[model samples]
Each structure stands twice: as C-alpha cells, then as structure tokens.
Target: MVGRTLTAVAKLSTVPAWVRRPLPAVAGVEDFLLRLYRRTESAEALAGFIALSWLGGEAADGPLLWAAPPEERFARAFLAVADALAEGESYPPPEWWRAEAGCLAPMTEAQWNERAGSWPERFYAHGVVCALGWVLGVFDDPAIMAPLHCGDGRSVGYGPREEWRVRLRACAVPLHLRNEEIAEWLRSGAGSQSGPAAVGAARATPSRSTG
Candidate 1:
C-alpha cells in the first residue's frame, strides 16, 4: 500500500520543477504546505500532510503545482476522496483552518532558521522527509484497519503514535545528508543512496515490516 501511494505520487509529472527541487529553505516548506493544504482542504486534515509528503518527493522544487489542468481539478480529487470518507458529514474544521492549524506553529523566523540549520540544509527539506515518514507510519498502523481494508469510510485512521515517531526518523535521512548523494546515505544505519530516485527505487523494494 505504501509503495503504491509513493508510485502514484511520483507519477504526477505536472508538479512544478521548482517544487521538485530538494532545497531545504523555509520558503520551500511554506510553499509546499500551502499548496498541499489548498488541494486537500476538504479531505481529511491529516491528508494534507500525507498529500504533500506522498506527492512531494525529495526532488520536488518550488510551490507544489498539480498535474491536473486547473488547481480546482486537484482540489476536487482530494475533496471527493475526503467527502467519501466523511459519509455525508461535514469536515470538522474548514480546510484552510485545518491546514493552518496543523502546519503553522508559532515559531519565530530565527527559530525556524536555527532548526533548519541543524538540519542538512534547511527545515523545509526536513519537513518533506518528516511528512513522508508520517504518511508511511499512518499506513502501517493497526488501529485504522478500516481505512486500509475499506476503500472509503468515515473511520479513516492516522495510525499509531509510536510508529509515527519511528517513521519520522526514517524520513529524516535526506535532510541530514543534503550535501551527500541520496543513494549513498545510510538510513537506520544501513547504507542507501541520497538521490531522490534512489529513495523512490528503495520504496519499490520489499523489506522487513518496520511496524
């Protein structure tokens, strides 16, 4: 399921080139989050983060643009999926508010920069990796068995908290090795490449269940 999601995201060719670049700047993070929030607003709140990380690969650059013709197209896709899950119920929070709440924490520019610096290049890159891990963790969780089993339902679950923490560590690899080749980096102390394609390729390979 996780591999399928990553493949689906990687197939989106219309995502802007700038959005595809692996820069770790704050602007990049904000842009990615904003676009993700805009598209997934009507969907699950957690979906925004998932959408960003799932679609926004390590190579994505600039603000995330949808492969769909108009922004509404992408928005509708997300809304349809989200609405189906809601089962005729309204989303608890407006999409924008949910995005703002989930993404925007009260951190000063200096703090963001400091954190970004602690990362390989910047915080945006770190966020991208974190977002991916978060998505994977949610998928691996056992509590939300319904979402995994059923196609669409109101019981969409976000997975276990412990799993999320472990996934976060896995996703932080690119951020920690910005200067190195992605394919050559080691994750969980195992050697892997630092390139985006390497990461994508890794997703396709079967490994022991992290859960």
Candidate 2:
C-alpha cells in the first residue's frame, strides 16, 4: 500500500510544472505528516494532515475537493481518528470505517481556534520547531488560510486573529525574519517592497527550536 501510494505520488509529480506550481508545497511536508499520522493516529495529526493536504499542490481535481469546504463528515472522521489515537485506544469505528459518523461539519472561525488550541501541546511544539522550512512570503499569501478554516470561525476575517497571523507571529520571527529587521523593513516606506527581501531580512537567521 505504501509502495502504491508512493507510485501514485511520483506519477502526480510528473505533471507539468506550470500546472503544479500553484499547488501547495505538500511534498516534503505531507510526507513527513503522513508518517506522523500513521505512527500516532491522533486527531491533531489527522487535522494537520488534512489541513496540509488541502493547502498543498494543485491537482486538476484539487479545487473541487477544496471547494467542498471542510464541513463534511469526512473531515470530522479524520479528527476523530486523531482523537482516538491520542487517547491510545483502539479506534472505535469498524475496520471499514475511516472516521466517526457525522464527523464532517462546517466549522466556524471560533471553532477552528478552539481546535487549534485543543491539539496536544506536542504537535504545536513540533510545528513550531519544524516551521523553519517555510520560505519567505509563504505566510503573506492569503491562500494559507484555506485549510486553517477547517470548520472554525477564528480562521477568517481581516487582520491578526487568523491562523496565519499566529503562525507568522510565532514562526516568522524566529525562523527567517528577525524582529528588528522586520520592523525596519516595514518602516522602510519603500512603497511596498517585493521579492524575498521584502518578506524577510537579507540574511537567513536560524531560530531556537521549540521542540
């Protein structure tokens, strides 16, 4: 099954770069996440998995799947799987069942924020540790909020309450962008700088691992 999944992934990778360019950067991150899910089988793991998958890489069918919104039962089942795994109990559902019944429900922003907080501290710790790989301007892109909305209201609206806002705040300063540098860049008043430098400092500074 693993081999088959890898084969499928490889086949998908062969598609035109132009076509794939818009897809979320799921390759490296997804692979790591899948292993984590298989091992831990926790709801937070599943949430992260689905969220990342939803965000990464565009397939011909990608938009359609994403269009469904994370409100469906399938999304809920995935979360239940994570919950079961975290508890160290055998999954209560039947072998053929993947997720809990009626798991899929449209999330509100407030709900998403609640779940984000609910995830075991370990996952966020790991996320904060691994967040260094994100490139400059990655968080600045508005699309990053899509998966975060996974049935929650906290993920929407303008300004900082969004998941990206928190992630950018927690991860950006330590990973690539320095606080002083970011402040300077914001204050530069260059009438909107573009490219990498605008997102972060010219020099890449490694941050302490939250792990």
Q: Tell me, by lDDT, which candidate is best.
A: 2
Q: What's the true lDDT of residue 177 in model 1?
A: 62
TM-score of each predicted structure versus truth = 0.23, 0.26
lDDT of 2 by residue, 102-163 (tens): 43333344533443454343242223212211222223432332222212222324542254
Q: Model 2: how far is 160 from its true place, Å?
A: 32
- Which regions of candidate 1 deviate over 4 angstroms? 1-84, 87-161, 172-211
Quality of model 2 by C-alpha lDDT = 0.35
lDDT of 1 by residue, 62-111 (tens): 11222222233333333332322224222234464345323322234454
What shift in Å separates residue 192 of candidate 1 from its native position after superposition? 31
